[model samples]
Target: MNQVTGAPGTSRPGGRTARVREAVLRAAGDALVDKGIGGVDLAEVARRAEVGKTTVYRRWGTVPGLVADMLAEMAESSLPRARTGALDTDLAALAGLILKTLADARQGPLFRAIIAAAASDAQTAAALHRFYRVRIEEWAPCVNEAVARGDVPEGTDAAEVVRALSAPLYYRFLVSGDPLDAGVAERAAVAASAAARAGVYA
Candidate 1:
C-alpha cells in the first residue's frame, strides 16, 4: 500500500474500529507533541493507546504513516467556515477561529511540533500542506460572496484573501513570537478586508 490509510484496518471509523483508531490517533498525537517526530514509535503509540503492538504496526506501519493519518483526521474534524453574510463579519469570524485554535494550550504546542516535523519529513510536509489546503478551500467562499455583493473587486482572488487573513496570526504563532490576541486578530481581518476591497488581491 502507498500509505497506512490504504491499509486494511483503515475504513471510516464506526464502532470498535473507530474507538481503536481514535485511541491510537490520540496516542500518536500525544507522543508527537511530547517527543517530536523522532520519538514517535509504533510500539510506544500502542502502549500509550492500550492497544496491541500488532494493531499499531498493522494499521500505521510507520511513523510517517501514523502522522499522515492523524493529519487527515484533524482536517476531517476541523470546523467549517463562517456563514455570516457580510464579508467583514465573515473574515472576522474566520480570524477568530484561527486565533482560538492557535491560542489553545494543547493545540498550540501540537501544531508547532507538527510544523517543525513537517520541515524535515516529506510525507509529513505533504500532509501538512493538504491540511491547510482544506482550510483555505473552506473559507475561500467568503471572498467569493464578497465579490457578488460588490464589497471587494470582482476579480479579487478569494484563496489569497483568506490566506492573507490568517498569515499574520500564523506569523505570531510560528515566528516573531509576538503575542496573539483579539486585537491582533481584528487587525488582520480589517487589513485583509480593506486590501481586498482595494483590489490588492485581484
Candidate 2:
C-alpha cells in the first residue's frame, strides 16, 4: 500500500504517491490552460504526467473532482492579499497584484479557463466561488484599516469594498477586452474609498 502524505497535491517525503498526485494536478492545470475544461481528459492527463490511467482515475474519480482538487491547490498556493497601514495604498497594492496575475500569459489563461468552466458546470462553479471567497477574506483587512483611520464609516462592508477593487479588472478580463490599465487599480481604490465614505459600503 502507498502512503498518503504531503500538501494536497505536492510531493511529501518525496514519495511516489505524492509525486503522482502532484503530476495529475499540474497536468490538469496545464490542460485547462491549453484545451479548456471540455478538452481535459483523465487518460490524456495521465499520459502527460507520465502516470498510469488507473492512478489518475483511482485518485480523482472524475473530471469535476480533479478540477476541484486543482482549484483547492491553487487557492492554497496563492499569497495573502496586502494590508499596509493605509487603506488606499493597501488596496492599490492588492489590485496591482490581482492585475499582475490576471495579465500573466499562463496564469491568466488558466484563470480564464476556470471562469469559463464555472459558467457551465455547477461543481466547477462552486469551486471558483469558494476560491474568490477566500481571496475576499484575505483582503478585507484593508477596508478595516480605512475604518480605523475614519476614512470610511465604521462597520463598512469590507468584503463588498474589496470586491469592487477587482470587479473592473474582471470586467476587462472577461468582457471589455481592454487593457488592465495601470491607473485602473488606483481608480478602483478611489471609487471604493468614496463609496465607503458615503456609507454605501456599510
Which candidate has the highest TM-score of all?
1
Residues 1-202, candidate 2: write the lDDT tens digits: 1221222232232487767768888889899888989999989999999999988887777777777777776666677767578877888888888888898887898889999998999878877777787778778877888888898898799999988878998899999998787788778877877777899978
TM-score of each: 0.94, 0.88
Candidate 2, run of 10 with poorest lDDT: 1-10
Residue 84 CA error for candidate 2 (Å)? 1.2
| lDDT per residue as tens, model 1, 42-77 | 899999999999988887788888888887777777
Angstrom error of the Cα, residue 13, model 2: value is 9.7
In model 1, the clashing pairs are none
Residue pair clashes in candidate 2: none
